[model samples]
Target: MLDTDTIGYLAATFTTTAFIPQAWLTWKTRRAEGVSLMMYSIFVVGIALWLLYGLLSHAWPVVVANVITLMLASFILLMKIVYK
Candidate 1:
């Protein structure tokens, strides 16, 4: 059986990777017309908070996932602003 942390990491990996396609599409197309600026703005803040929470709680999976996710999300958010 997989350990709890292992499962957590697996979950994190899946979720974080799932966002890659959207980020890639937005980046490649250089258009964010379908992306909502307010939503991405809120999402970036939330991800940042999650990263902070993970850091404080010593959750490696959370830390790693949120770090990557925060980067991706922030990138999307920036694109949204710039493309708007």
Candidate 2:
């Protein structure tokens, strides 16, 4: 059986990596017309807070997942602004 941390890592991996295809598509197309600026903006902030929470709580899985997710989410948010 998988340990709790292992399960956390697995869940984190799936959720974090799930954003890749959308990010890639947005990057390749260089268009964010379908992306909502307000939503992404709010999401980025939430992710940042989650990252801080992870750091404060010493949760490696949360930290790692939020780090990558933050990067990807920020990139998308930036693209949304720039592409607009």
- Clashing residue pair totals per candidate (backbone < 3 A): 0, 0
Global lDDT for candidate 2?
Answer: 0.94
In angstroms, what RMSD does candidate 2 have relative to the true structure?
Answer: 0.6
User: Number of the top candidate by lDDT?
Assistant: 2
User: Candidate 1, which segments miss by more than 4 Å at Cα?
Assistant: none
Model 2 off-target regions past 4 Å?
none
Query: Compared to the true structure, candidate 2 yields what TM-score?
Result: 0.97
TM-score of each: 0.96, 0.97
Residue 50 shift from truth in candidate 1, angstroms:
0.9
How does candidate 1 fare on TM-score?
Answer: 0.96
Using TM-score as the measure, which candidate wins? 2
Write the residue-wise lDDT of candidate 2 on 1-84 in tens digits.
Answer: 899899989999999998898799999999999889999999999999999999999999999999999999999999999999
lDDT tens per residue, model 1, 31-76: 9999988898898899899999999999999999999999998898
